[model samples]
Target: MAVHSPTSGPCRSIVVSKLVAPATRRSLENMSRRSGVDLFFSSTLSSAELTDRAAVAVVVPVPHAEDEVMEMVHRIRELAPTILLCGVIDVPDQSLWLFAERNGFNLVSSAGGIGAALSRRLAADDLGVREPIAVLNSSDIAGRLGLLGEFEVEGCSVALWRGGGRLGCLENRCTHSGAKLSEGEVEDGVVTCPRHGSRFDIVSGERVRGPADSDVKHFDVFEREGRVWIVPEP
Candidate 1:
Protein backbone atom coordinates (compact mmCIF):
# COMPACT_ATOMS: atom_id res chain seq x y z
CA MET A 1 0.00 0.00 0.00
CA ALA A 2 1.38 3.42 -0.94
CA VAL A 3 0.93 5.50 2.14
CA HIS A 4 0.04 8.99 1.03
CA SER A 5 1.57 11.48 3.35
CA PRO A 6 -0.81 14.07 4.71
CA THR A 7 2.07 16.50 4.63
CA SER A 8 3.66 18.00 1.54
CA GLY A 9 6.41 15.45 0.96
CA PRO A 10 6.04 11.72 0.44
CA CYS A 11 5.59 9.77 3.64
CA ARG A 12 9.19 8.78 2.72
CA SER A 13 11.66 9.12 -0.12
CA ILE A 14 13.81 6.50 -1.87
CA VAL A 15 17.61 6.68 -2.04
CA VAL A 16 19.48 4.10 -4.02
CA SER A 17 22.19 2.76 -1.74
CA LYS A 18 24.75 1.77 -4.32
CA LEU A 19 23.17 4.21 -6.73
CA VAL A 20 23.55 7.15 -4.42
CA ALA A 21 24.76 9.57 -7.05
CA PRO A 22 25.67 13.03 -5.82
CA ALA A 23 22.95 14.47 -7.99
CA THR A 24 20.48 11.95 -6.58
CA ARG A 25 21.31 12.98 -3.05
CA ARG A 26 20.84 16.60 -4.00
CA SER A 27 17.50 15.84 -5.53
CA LEU A 28 16.32 13.92 -2.48
CA GLU A 29 17.54 16.58 -0.12
CA ASN A 30 16.01 19.35 -2.19
CA MET A 31 12.64 17.69 -1.86
CA SER A 32 13.35 16.14 1.51
CA ARG A 33 10.62 18.17 3.15
CA ARG A 34 7.99 16.48 0.99
CA SER A 35 9.34 12.98 0.59
CA GLY A 36 9.14 10.65 3.55
CA VAL A 37 10.60 7.34 2.31
CA ASP A 38 14.10 7.01 0.93
CA LEU A 39 14.39 4.03 -1.41
CA PHE A 40 17.91 2.81 -1.85
CA PHE A 41 17.37 1.78 -5.42
CA SER A 42 20.24 -0.68 -5.16
CA SER A 43 22.65 -1.73 -2.45
CA THR A 44 24.60 1.45 -3.04
CA LEU A 45 24.05 3.51 0.06
CA SER A 46 27.20 3.81 2.12
CA SER A 47 26.93 2.29 5.56
CA ALA A 48 27.26 5.66 7.23
CA GLU A 49 24.08 7.27 5.81
CA LEU A 50 21.45 4.50 6.16
CA THR A 51 20.85 4.76 9.89
CA ASP A 52 20.83 8.43 10.78
CA ARG A 53 17.73 9.49 8.88
CA ALA A 54 14.19 8.76 9.93
CA ALA A 55 13.16 7.94 6.36
CA VAL A 56 12.53 4.40 5.12
CA ALA A 57 15.11 2.89 2.76
CA VAL A 58 14.48 0.31 0.03
CA VAL A 59 17.61 -1.77 -0.56
CA VAL A 60 18.07 -3.44 -3.90
CA PRO A 61 20.55 -6.08 -5.01
CA VAL A 62 24.20 -5.32 -5.42
CA PRO A 63 27.10 -7.50 -6.53
CA HIS A 64 28.35 -7.66 -2.99
CA ALA A 65 29.91 -10.78 -1.53
CA GLU A 66 28.51 -12.75 1.41
CA ASP A 67 30.35 -10.84 4.12
CA GLU A 68 29.32 -7.52 2.59
CA VAL A 69 25.66 -8.48 2.62
CA MET A 70 25.86 -9.51 6.25
CA GLU A 71 27.37 -6.19 7.13
CA MET A 72 24.67 -4.38 5.23
CA VAL A 73 21.98 -6.36 7.04
CA HIS A 74 23.42 -5.37 10.37
CA ARG A 75 23.35 -1.72 9.43
CA ILE A 76 19.87 -2.06 7.97
CA ARG A 77 18.58 -3.35 11.28
CA GLU A 78 20.13 -0.43 13.04
CA LEU A 79 18.36 1.94 10.68
CA ALA A 80 14.96 0.33 11.09
CA PRO A 81 11.93 1.91 9.51
CA THR A 82 10.26 -0.08 6.75
CA ILE A 83 12.68 -1.85 4.35
CA LEU A 84 11.62 -3.12 0.94
CA LEU A 85 14.23 -5.22 -0.87
CA CYS A 86 14.10 -5.41 -4.64
CA GLY A 87 15.87 -7.21 -7.53
CA VAL A 88 17.49 -9.86 -5.33
CA ILE A 89 19.14 -12.66 -7.29
CA ASP A 90 19.31 -16.01 -5.56
CA VAL A 91 22.88 -17.07 -5.35
CA PRO A 92 24.67 -19.42 -2.97
CA ASP A 93 22.03 -18.88 -0.25
CA GLN A 94 19.08 -16.87 1.03
CA SER A 95 20.86 -15.11 3.88
CA LEU A 96 19.90 -11.53 2.96
CA TRP A 97 16.17 -12.16 3.15
CA LEU A 98 16.49 -14.19 6.31
CA PHE A 99 18.63 -11.64 8.07
CA ALA A 100 16.35 -8.76 7.11
CA GLU A 101 13.20 -10.40 8.49
CA ARG A 102 15.02 -11.64 11.56
CA ASN A 103 15.96 -8.06 12.31
CA GLY A 104 12.37 -6.86 11.75
CA PHE A 105 12.96 -5.51 8.24
CA ASN A 106 9.96 -6.11 5.99
CA LEU A 107 11.15 -8.36 3.16
CA VAL A 108 9.52 -7.62 -0.22
CA SER A 109 10.59 -8.94 -3.56
CA SER A 110 12.34 -6.86 -6.17
CA ALA A 111 11.31 -9.24 -8.91
CA GLY A 112 8.85 -8.88 -11.75
CA GLY A 113 5.29 -8.89 -10.43
CA ILE A 114 5.60 -7.97 -6.77
CA GLY A 115 8.63 -5.77 -7.32
CA ALA A 116 6.73 -3.67 -9.79
CA ALA A 117 3.81 -3.46 -7.39
CA LEU A 118 6.02 -2.24 -4.56
CA SER A 119 7.76 0.31 -6.79
CA ARG A 120 4.44 1.66 -7.94
CA ARG A 121 3.10 1.89 -4.40
CA LEU A 122 6.17 3.72 -3.15
CA ALA A 123 6.07 6.04 -6.12
CA ALA A 124 2.45 6.82 -5.30
CA ASP A 125 3.17 7.40 -1.62
CA ASP A 126 0.69 4.92 -0.22
CA LEU A 127 1.51 2.62 2.70
CA GLY A 128 -1.94 1.45 3.56
CA VAL A 129 -1.55 -1.61 5.80
CA ARG A 130 1.50 -3.77 6.37
CA GLU A 131 -0.38 -7.04 5.94
CA PRO A 132 0.10 -9.98 3.59
CA ILE A 133 -2.28 -10.61 0.67
CA ALA A 134 -2.76 -13.98 -0.98
CA VAL A 135 -2.19 -14.05 -4.72
CA LEU A 136 -1.75 -17.71 -5.77
CA ASN A 137 -3.54 -20.70 -4.21
CA SER A 138 -2.70 -24.33 -4.71
CA SER A 139 -4.57 -27.50 -3.84
CA ASP A 140 -3.33 -29.72 -6.62
CA ILE A 141 -2.51 -32.91 -4.80
CA ALA A 142 -1.58 -34.87 -7.88
CA GLY A 143 1.21 -32.89 -9.53
CA ARG A 144 2.67 -30.37 -7.04
CA LEU A 145 0.17 -30.71 -4.20
CA GLY A 146 1.33 -27.60 -2.38
CA LEU A 147 -0.19 -24.24 -1.64
CA LEU A 148 1.30 -21.36 -3.67
CA GLY A 149 0.37 -17.95 -2.31
CA GLU A 150 1.78 -14.47 -3.07
CA PHE A 151 2.16 -11.91 -0.35
CA GLU A 152 0.99 -8.64 -1.94
CA VAL A 153 -0.25 -7.54 1.42
CA GLU A 154 1.98 -4.48 1.10
CA GLY A 155 2.46 -4.13 -2.66
CA CYS A 156 5.21 -6.77 -2.84
CA SER A 157 5.19 -10.52 -3.28
CA VAL A 158 6.10 -12.13 -0.02
CA ALA A 159 4.84 -15.57 -1.09
CA LEU A 160 3.56 -17.83 1.62
CA TRP A 161 2.26 -21.38 2.03
CA ARG A 162 0.36 -23.52 4.54
CA GLY A 163 -0.30 -27.01 3.28
CA GLY A 164 -0.69 -30.24 5.24
CA GLY A 165 -0.60 -28.28 8.47
CA ARG A 166 2.79 -26.82 7.57
CA LEU A 167 3.44 -23.08 7.24
CA GLY A 168 6.18 -21.22 5.35
CA CYS A 169 6.85 -17.90 3.66
CA LEU A 170 9.73 -16.62 1.59
CA GLU A 171 10.84 -13.47 -0.25
CA ASN A 172 9.74 -15.10 -3.53
CA ARG A 173 13.34 -15.67 -4.64
CA CYS A 174 15.02 -19.02 -4.55
CA THR A 175 18.29 -19.17 -2.69
CA HIS A 176 19.98 -21.31 -5.33
CA SER A 177 20.51 -18.28 -7.57
CA GLY A 178 17.45 -16.05 -7.90
CA ALA A 179 14.73 -18.46 -9.05
CA LYS A 180 11.33 -17.78 -7.58
CA LEU A 181 11.10 -19.82 -4.40
CA SER A 182 7.33 -19.69 -4.77
CA GLU A 183 7.64 -21.72 -7.98
CA GLY A 184 9.93 -24.23 -6.27
CA GLU A 185 8.87 -27.54 -4.76
CA VAL A 186 7.78 -28.17 -1.19
CA GLU A 187 7.14 -31.66 0.10
CA ASP A 188 7.26 -33.33 3.48
CA GLY A 189 8.40 -30.09 5.08
CA VAL A 190 11.13 -29.34 2.55
CA VAL A 191 11.09 -26.63 -0.12
CA THR A 192 13.24 -27.52 -3.07
CA CYS A 193 14.99 -24.79 -4.93
CA PRO A 194 13.95 -24.75 -8.57
CA ARG A 195 17.37 -23.77 -9.83
CA HIS A 196 19.47 -26.44 -8.21
CA GLY A 197 19.44 -29.29 -5.68
CA SER A 198 18.76 -27.12 -2.65
CA ARG A 199 16.04 -27.77 -0.09
CA PHE A 200 14.66 -25.64 2.73
CA ASP A 201 12.36 -26.40 5.60
CA ILE A 202 9.01 -24.77 4.96
CA VAL A 203 8.27 -24.17 8.62
CA SER A 204 11.70 -22.78 9.52
CA GLY A 205 12.88 -21.82 5.99
CA GLU A 206 16.34 -23.14 6.74
CA ARG A 207 18.25 -24.53 3.79
CA VAL A 208 18.70 -28.05 5.10
CA ARG A 209 21.29 -29.13 2.51
CA GLY A 210 23.12 -28.47 -0.74
CA PRO A 211 24.66 -25.10 -1.69
CA ALA A 212 22.24 -23.02 0.38
CA ASP A 213 23.39 -22.03 3.83
CA SER A 214 21.17 -18.95 4.03
CA ASP A 215 17.63 -19.19 5.36
CA VAL A 216 14.49 -17.94 3.63
CA LYS A 217 12.17 -15.65 5.51
CA HIS A 218 9.43 -17.09 7.72
CA PHE A 219 6.57 -14.71 8.46
CA ASP A 220 3.78 -15.04 10.98
CA VAL A 221 0.97 -17.01 9.31
CA PHE A 222 -2.74 -17.00 10.07
CA GLU A 223 -5.87 -18.31 8.34
CA ARG A 224 -9.40 -17.05 8.50
CA GLU A 225 -12.46 -17.69 6.32
CA GLY A 226 -10.46 -20.05 4.15
CA ARG A 227 -7.90 -17.39 3.40
CA VAL A 228 -4.30 -17.22 4.61
CA TRP A 229 -2.41 -14.16 5.75
CA ILE A 230 1.30 -13.49 6.31
CA VAL A 231 2.03 -10.86 8.90
CA PRO A 232 5.48 -9.48 9.61
CA GLU A 233 6.39 -9.34 13.26
CA PRO A 234 6.51 -5.82 14.68
Candidate 2:
Protein backbone atom coordinates (compact mmCIF):
# COMPACT_ATOMS: atom_id res chain seq x y z
CA MET A 1 0.00 0.00 0.00
CA ALA A 2 1.37 3.42 -0.96
CA VAL A 3 0.67 5.72 2.01
CA HIS A 4 1.77 9.27 2.81
CA SER A 5 1.16 11.82 5.52
CA PRO A 6 0.34 15.27 4.24
CA THR A 7 3.77 16.53 5.31
CA SER A 8 5.70 13.44 4.18
CA GLY A 9 4.82 13.89 0.51
CA PRO A 10 5.14 10.29 -0.76
CA CYS A 11 5.40 7.95 2.25
CA ARG A 12 6.26 4.76 0.39
CA SER A 13 9.99 4.61 0.98
CA ILE A 14 11.96 1.63 2.42
CA VAL A 15 15.27 1.81 4.22
CA VAL A 16 17.69 -0.95 3.12
CA SER A 17 20.55 -1.89 5.46
CA LYS A 18 23.21 -2.99 2.97
CA LEU A 19 25.23 -1.22 0.35
CA VAL A 20 24.62 -1.86 -3.31
CA ALA A 21 26.50 -0.18 -6.11
CA PRO A 22 25.01 3.23 -6.87
CA ALA A 23 23.99 2.08 -10.33
CA THR A 24 22.18 -0.94 -8.93
CA ARG A 25 20.46 1.25 -6.33
CA ARG A 26 19.30 3.74 -8.92
CA SER A 27 18.06 1.01 -11.23
CA LEU A 28 16.18 -0.77 -8.43
CA GLU A 29 14.78 2.48 -7.08
CA ASN A 30 13.55 3.50 -10.51
CA MET A 31 11.94 0.13 -11.14
CA SER A 32 10.27 -0.05 -7.69
CA ARG A 33 9.04 3.54 -7.60
CA ARG A 34 7.16 2.93 -10.81
CA SER A 35 4.99 0.83 -8.48
CA GLY A 36 4.81 3.79 -6.04
CA VAL A 37 7.41 2.45 -3.58
CA ASP A 38 10.83 4.04 -3.06
CA LEU A 39 14.07 2.32 -1.97
CA PHE A 40 16.55 4.08 0.31
CA PHE A 41 19.83 2.62 1.62
CA SER A 42 21.59 3.08 4.93
CA SER A 43 24.22 0.43 5.70
CA THR A 44 24.17 1.46 9.35
CA LEU A 45 20.44 2.16 9.70
CA SER A 46 19.35 4.35 12.56
CA SER A 47 16.12 3.79 14.45
CA ALA A 48 15.62 7.52 14.80
CA GLU A 49 15.25 7.68 11.04
CA LEU A 50 12.70 4.86 11.17
CA THR A 51 10.51 5.91 14.15
CA ASP A 52 10.50 9.59 13.36
CA ARG A 53 7.96 8.79 10.67
CA ALA A 54 4.44 7.40 10.94
CA ALA A 55 4.67 4.34 8.62
CA VAL A 56 8.02 2.90 7.55
CA ALA A 57 9.30 -0.58 6.70
CA VAL A 58 12.96 -1.39 7.30
CA VAL A 59 14.51 -4.03 5.03
CA VAL A 60 17.69 -5.66 6.27
CA PRO A 61 19.79 -8.24 4.47
CA VAL A 62 20.51 -11.03 6.95
CA PRO A 63 24.22 -11.31 7.61
CA HIS A 64 25.99 -14.68 7.49
CA ALA A 65 27.24 -14.95 11.04
CA GLU A 66 24.84 -15.42 13.98
CA ASP A 67 26.64 -12.87 16.15
CA GLU A 68 26.72 -10.12 13.54
CA VAL A 69 23.00 -10.34 12.92
CA MET A 70 22.13 -10.38 16.61
CA GLU A 71 24.36 -7.36 17.15
CA MET A 72 22.63 -5.49 14.39
CA VAL A 73 19.18 -6.34 15.70
CA HIS A 74 20.03 -5.23 19.21
CA ARG A 75 21.50 -1.96 17.97
CA ILE A 76 18.41 -1.06 15.98
CA ARG A 77 16.01 -1.93 18.82
CA GLU A 78 18.06 0.08 21.29
CA LEU A 79 18.19 3.16 19.11
CA ALA A 80 14.57 3.04 18.09
CA PRO A 81 13.19 2.43 21.64
CA THR A 82 9.76 3.27 20.24
CA ILE A 83 7.53 0.93 18.29
CA LEU A 84 9.68 -0.95 15.80
CA LEU A 85 8.70 -2.94 12.74
CA CYS A 86 11.46 -5.19 11.44
CA GLY A 87 11.85 -7.54 8.49
CA VAL A 88 14.77 -9.45 6.91
CA ILE A 89 15.53 -10.66 3.39
CA ASP A 90 18.22 -12.65 1.56
CA VAL A 91 18.79 -14.94 4.49
CA PRO A 92 21.60 -17.27 3.47
CA ASP A 93 20.52 -20.28 5.54
CA GLN A 94 17.93 -21.67 7.97
CA SER A 95 19.95 -21.12 11.13
CA LEU A 96 20.37 -17.47 10.28
CA TRP A 97 16.70 -17.22 9.37
CA LEU A 98 15.66 -18.61 12.75
CA PHE A 99 18.06 -16.32 14.54
CA ALA A 100 16.79 -13.25 12.73
CA GLU A 101 13.09 -13.96 13.15
CA ARG A 102 13.63 -14.78 16.81
CA ASN A 103 15.42 -11.52 17.43
CA GLY A 104 13.09 -8.96 15.79
CA PHE A 105 12.89 -9.53 12.03
CA ASN A 106 9.39 -10.87 11.45
CA LEU A 107 9.52 -10.86 7.68
CA VAL A 108 12.06 -13.39 6.38
CA SER A 109 12.77 -14.32 2.75
CA SER A 110 15.31 -14.55 -0.05
CA ALA A 111 16.13 -11.73 -2.41
CA GLY A 112 14.16 -12.87 -5.46
CA GLY A 113 10.80 -12.84 -3.65
CA ILE A 114 11.26 -9.70 -1.58
CA GLY A 115 9.13 -7.42 -3.77
CA ALA A 116 5.89 -9.16 -2.83
CA ALA A 117 7.09 -9.90 0.70
CA LEU A 118 7.67 -6.20 1.37
CA SER A 119 4.33 -5.28 -0.08
CA ARG A 120 2.50 -7.78 2.12
CA ARG A 121 4.30 -6.78 5.30
CA LEU A 122 3.97 -3.05 4.71
CA ALA A 123 0.27 -3.37 4.04
CA ALA A 124 -0.14 -5.25 7.32
CA ASP A 125 1.75 -2.55 9.16
CA ASP A 126 -0.61 0.05 7.80
CA LEU A 127 -3.47 -1.99 9.24
CA GLY A 128 -1.85 -2.39 12.73
CA VAL A 129 -1.94 -6.17 12.62
CA ARG A 130 0.98 -7.94 14.28
CA GLU A 131 1.23 -11.69 13.94
CA PRO A 132 2.01 -13.84 16.95
CA ILE A 133 4.28 -16.20 15.05
CA ALA A 134 7.32 -15.56 12.88
CA VAL A 135 7.02 -17.51 9.67
CA LEU A 136 10.20 -19.07 8.25
CA ASN A 137 11.76 -17.59 5.17
CA SER A 138 11.51 -20.05 2.31
CA SER A 139 14.61 -18.55 0.71
CA ASP A 140 16.74 -21.31 2.20
CA ILE A 141 13.94 -23.72 1.47
CA ALA A 142 13.82 -22.44 -2.11
CA GLY A 143 17.53 -23.18 -2.51
CA ARG A 144 17.29 -26.54 -0.83
CA LEU A 145 14.14 -27.62 -2.63
CA GLY A 146 15.23 -26.31 -6.04
CA LEU A 147 18.45 -28.37 -5.72
CA LEU A 148 16.45 -31.51 -4.84
CA GLY A 149 17.50 -31.11 -1.25
CA GLU A 150 15.34 -32.55 1.52
CA PHE A 151 12.84 -30.48 3.56
CA GLU A 152 9.26 -30.92 4.72
CA VAL A 153 6.86 -28.24 5.81
CA GLU A 154 5.02 -29.94 8.70
CA GLY A 155 2.57 -27.07 9.11
CA CYS A 156 2.90 -24.43 6.37
CA SER A 157 5.83 -23.31 4.24
CA VAL A 158 5.90 -19.76 2.94
CA ALA A 159 8.16 -19.93 -0.09
CA LEU A 160 9.36 -17.21 -2.33
CA TRP A 161 10.05 -19.90 -4.85
CA ARG A 162 12.90 -20.02 -7.34
CA GLY A 163 10.84 -21.15 -10.32
CA GLY A 164 7.89 -18.79 -10.34
CA GLY A 165 9.97 -15.97 -8.89
CA ARG A 166 6.89 -15.27 -6.76
CA LEU A 167 6.07 -15.48 -3.07
CA GLY A 168 3.57 -18.23 -2.20
CA CYS A 169 2.97 -20.88 0.47
CA LEU A 170 2.30 -24.45 -0.54
CA GLU A 171 2.03 -27.67 1.38
CA ASN A 172 5.20 -29.24 -0.08
CA ARG A 173 3.99 -32.77 0.38
CA CYS A 174 3.57 -35.32 -2.37
CA THR A 175 -0.12 -35.80 -2.98
CA HIS A 176 0.56 -39.55 -3.25
CA SER A 177 2.42 -41.52 -0.58
CA GLY A 178 2.76 -38.19 1.36
CA ALA A 179 6.38 -37.68 0.36
CA LYS A 180 8.27 -34.44 0.84
CA LEU A 181 8.28 -32.37 -2.35
CA SER A 182 11.56 -30.72 -1.42
CA GLU A 183 13.35 -34.05 -2.00
CA GLY A 184 12.28 -33.86 -5.64
CA GLU A 185 12.79 -31.53 -8.57
CA VAL A 186 11.04 -28.25 -9.49
CA GLU A 187 10.98 -27.42 -13.17
CA ASP A 188 8.72 -25.19 -15.27
CA GLY A 189 6.81 -24.11 -12.14
CA VAL A 190 6.00 -27.67 -11.09
CA VAL A 191 7.28 -29.48 -7.98
CA THR A 192 7.88 -33.22 -8.08
CA CYS A 193 7.50 -35.74 -5.34
CA PRO A 194 10.67 -37.83 -5.04
CA ARG A 195 8.94 -40.97 -3.78
CA HIS A 196 7.36 -41.95 -7.12
CA GLY A 197 8.23 -38.98 -9.39
CA SER A 198 4.83 -37.36 -8.91
CA ARG A 199 4.63 -33.69 -9.98
CA PHE A 200 2.31 -30.80 -9.11
CA ASP A 201 2.09 -27.26 -10.35
CA ILE A 202 3.75 -24.96 -7.84
CA VAL A 203 1.39 -22.09 -8.51
CA SER A 204 -2.00 -23.78 -8.30
CA GLY A 205 -0.93 -26.96 -6.49
CA GLU A 206 -2.73 -28.89 -9.19
CA ARG A 207 -1.55 -32.38 -9.92
CA VAL A 208 0.35 -32.35 -13.19
CA ARG A 209 1.60 -35.96 -13.27
CA GLY A 210 1.25 -38.79 -10.89
CA PRO A 211 1.53 -41.28 -8.71
CA ALA A 212 -0.03 -38.27 -6.99
CA ASP A 213 -3.76 -38.04 -7.59
CA SER A 214 -4.59 -34.95 -5.51
CA ASP A 215 -3.43 -31.35 -5.51
CA VAL A 216 -1.10 -29.93 -2.89
CA LYS A 217 -2.47 -27.15 -0.66
CA HIS A 218 -1.64 -23.49 -1.15
CA PHE A 219 -1.80 -20.91 1.66
CA ASP A 220 -1.93 -17.14 1.69
CA VAL A 221 1.06 -15.37 3.29
CA PHE A 222 1.12 -11.82 4.69
CA GLU A 223 3.26 -9.66 6.94
CA ARG A 224 2.78 -7.36 9.94
CA GLU A 225 4.78 -6.44 13.07
CA GLY A 226 8.07 -7.32 11.40
CA ARG A 227 7.23 -10.90 10.38
CA VAL A 228 5.57 -12.64 7.47
CA TRP A 229 2.72 -15.04 8.35
CA ILE A 230 1.00 -18.04 6.76
CA VAL A 231 -2.76 -17.85 6.55
CA PRO A 232 -4.20 -20.92 8.25
CA GLU A 233 -6.71 -23.19 6.54
CA PRO A 234 -10.24 -22.13 7.34
Each prediction's Cα lDDT score? 0.50, 0.54
lDDT of 2 by residue, 96-196 (tens): 77656644555666655566666665566563422223455434343443432222334554343446443344676666887767666677667767788
Instruction: Rate residue 145 of model 2 by lDDT.
Output: 34
Candidate 1 segments exceeding 4 Å error: 1-144
In model 1, what is the error at residue 2, expressed in angstroms? 37
Best by TM-score: 2
Instruction: Give the range of the ten consecutive residues with the poorest summed lDDT in model 2.
Output: 144-153
Q: How do the residues 46-130 of candidate 1 rate in per-residue lDDT, one tens digit apiece?
A: 4444432334445445334645654555455334323443334334356655544433334434333334444454555454324
Q: What is the Å distance of residue 50 in model 2 from its true position?
A: 1.9
TM-scores of all candidate predictions against the true structure: 0.38, 0.43
- Residue 69, candidate 1: alpha-carbon lDDT: 55
* Global local distance difference test of model 2: 0.54
